[model samples]
Target: MTGTGALARMQAAFASAVTDGDEAAVTAHLAGDPALARRRLAIYREAIGANRRGALRSAFPVVARLVGEAFFDEAARRLAAVAPPACADLNRYGDGFPAFLSTYPHAEAMRWLADVARLEWAWHEALSAADATGIDFAALAAVPAEEQPALRFSLHPSVRLVRSAWPVLAIWEANQPGRDGTPDRDEGADDVLAWREDGRVRMALLAPPDAAFVEAIGRGTPLEVAAGSEGWDFAPMLVRLAAHGLLAGFAGPQSAG
Candidate 1:
């Protein structure tokens, strides 16, 4: 390999050893100065450790509470080793964790964990996407009747919808502080729409079709198509969006047919 290729190979080996538990390859890659190699690799190991755990802990605080901090830390380590940060921004680190948990043997034992992680990740991402001011109703009202049919609305940055095949909202609620009453061990599913209000993520339960309709709109389906959706009442979808601060305002519009 040329100099650039050789350097690339060295870095790749270094990363693999630090996060992949390949001790033999790690030591070999270090070669002449084992101490220096070990020391240099240690920085990456420490960095991946801190960023993964911190990001996961921030997103899944309640799950951490249920599992306790020490156990959570150990689990976070395993998770980090298997799926370290790919994004430069550590804030985006836990995006894949829910899927990872679903496949992890231990996580299969606690089936609820995957969904909990999903909910947490949604909140984390929604809190970071670009922000928008509250609906500009005045500007919307100014649009002429003829132009109302071409408007499409954008959602607020902090608004997010999480759809799960588990009772994620109940699980989340049972673990919350003031709401930590009796726990429900029932098998159920729910959708949740979360958003930041006054700088905190607020979550509200959503019905299935309502969740589906919003998803359809996000997919660029027209308002009329989304609202008149077959087998689903679109009114409730509107209510949920209004309640969650998801609606920034109309963009282009169509007639209220």
Candidate 2:
């Protein structure tokens, strides 16, 4: 095998040994005395496991805190075993964790835990999302009145909308470092808007109509349809989103031509 091929093979073997407890696959790659090599490989396995667990813990600190260290650690271990990282970047490793938690048998009692995890993941993504420039209001204004309704606006890359039956936003806020207290009402639904602004991740609770409007726009709906029923004032919501840097840009009907 070429050097690159050998390296790839070794990496695959090491991953299988660490993640599956199958040391035989990687045994041939180790040098030195057989016994010492096995012992060192064991150490390496433990370190790799710890790093995976650490990545999970870092991504889902609120979940870890809520479930306690022992429970969270085991869950993390299970997740790593089932859904090993596809890429080397551990920061992007736990996108499926929220779905896993929702179906996790031990987590059934805390029904809201999964939604809270989703919120945290959104916050994490927003923090890491690429920076974007705001929309050109002058360009937007130049569109003729008849063509305005066909315009489709784009949200900032960091914008994420999360709607959950539980009070996820309140739960997330309450679990923040040094914060204390439970949500005032846990049963009510919440429409959360998460996005990055000025290099900080920010989350806000949106009213039902506002959430629907934003969701529609996010789906690439034309301005006319996203505006919903006639006589309902959507101008304020547009202004608010634009003011917050959530509006990235817009494409008119002719742009698709």
Candidate 3:
């Protein structure tokens, strides 16, 4: 083999061995001693694997707390084995964790755990999202009534909605530090409205109608269409959204009046 081709092949083999735990492939490429090479590979694997699992633990501390450390660590290892980090940025590595937990055999009895993970991920994203200057509400109100229906509203960059059949918000709140009292297991379905305000991520439980309104707007629906969505009443929900400063801006035809 040419020098360049041999080097490329060795690099690929090394990567596959490191990530896939293929000791035999790596041992074949050892320079001096096979035992030394195995020891080095073992150390590398232990350190890198722990680092990756640590990132997941940090991102999903509540999950760790819920499932306990030993069990959570086992799940994290399994996740890393199947879905190794595709990006250099570890912060973005665990997006599939919630889905993984949902299908995990041990977690099937705790269906709500996955939703809680989703909420934590959303909150994490909101914390890192860009800031937005709120909309000019006075100008929005001043727009001609006839043109209002066509207006397209934009939510704040930090705004995120999490809809689940489980009472995720209540469960999350109950698990918070210093929180007392048991969470009601039968609290029913909930939709969470999350946003960053004053440099902190905050969340509120949305009513079904309000959840539909926000979901419609998030899909780029026109104001009139979102307002007229089934089970939605535009006025109070609009007031609540404005109060939360979620209306980042709007665009539409210029008012003739």
Candidate 4:
């Protein structure tokens, strides 16, 4: 094999040994006494597992706290075994964890756990998302009244909407540091909006209509259509979003005209 190919093969062998415990395939590449080489490889395997657990713990602290260290560690190990990290960046390693938790046999009783995990992941993503320039109010004011309804607004890149049948937001808030672990109520649905502002991740509980409106806006829906439902005024919501710097920009027929 060429040098590059040889290096790739070695790396693959090492990965299999450390991640899967299939040491026989990599035994030939060992550099010292056979037993000592095996021991060193064992240490590497343990270290890698610890790293995976640490990453998951960081991404899902609430989950860890809820399940306790033993349960969380075991779940983390199982997740790593089933779906190893696809990239070198450990920060992104737990993207699949919420889905994994949803179907996790041991977590079956805590049906709401998956939704909570989803919210936590959104917070993590919002924190990691790129910063965006706030809406240009001067330009927004310049749009003709007739064309305003057709405008499509952009949400900040960090904005995330999560709707769940469980009281996920309340549960999450209750679990925050220095708070009692009891949520105000535990049976109702929740609509959560997560975003980053001033280098901090912020979350809010949205009413159903407002959540729908924000979801529509995030999907690039036009203003008129997004607010088309009768008996609801989206003005306050709009003002609130603007105040929070959630509106990134806007474009529509006016821009083309």
Highest-lDDT candidate = 4
Off by over 4 Å in 1: 1-13, 21-47, 68-75, 142-151, 177-187, 229-244, 253-257
Q: Please, what is the whole-model Cα lDDT of each candidate in the order they appear? A: 0.74, 0.89, 0.84, 0.93
Backbone atom clashes (below 3 Å) for every candidate: 8, 0, 0, 0
Q: Put down candidate 2 lDDT per residue, 40-137, tens digits, no spaces.
A: 87888789889988988898888888889999989988888888888899999899899999999999999999999998899899999988878999
Deviation in Å, model 4, residue 56 alpha carbon: 1.0
Instruction: Give the least accurate 10-residue stretch of model 2, judged by summed lDDT.
Output: 179-188
* Model 4 misplaced regions, further than 4 Å: 254-257
lDDT of 3 by residue, 104-210 (tens): 99899888999999998888888888888889978887888898888888898988999999988888887777765257665779899988988899999988878
Q: How well is each residue in 152-216 modelled by candidate 4, as lDDT tens digits?
A: 99999999999999999989988899987799887789999999999999999999999999999
Model 2 TM-score, all chains together = 0.93
Query: Between prediction 1 and prediction 2, which has the larger TM-score?
Result: 2
Q: How many pairs of residues in model 4 come into backbone collision?
A: 0
Query: Residue 164 error for model 2, in Å?
Result: 0.3
Q: Is candidate 1 or candidate 4 better by TM-score?
A: 4
Candidate achieving the largest TM-score: 4
Candidate no. 4 TM-score: 0.95
Error of 4 at 130 (Å): 0.8
Residue 177 CA error for candidate 3 (Å)? 2.0
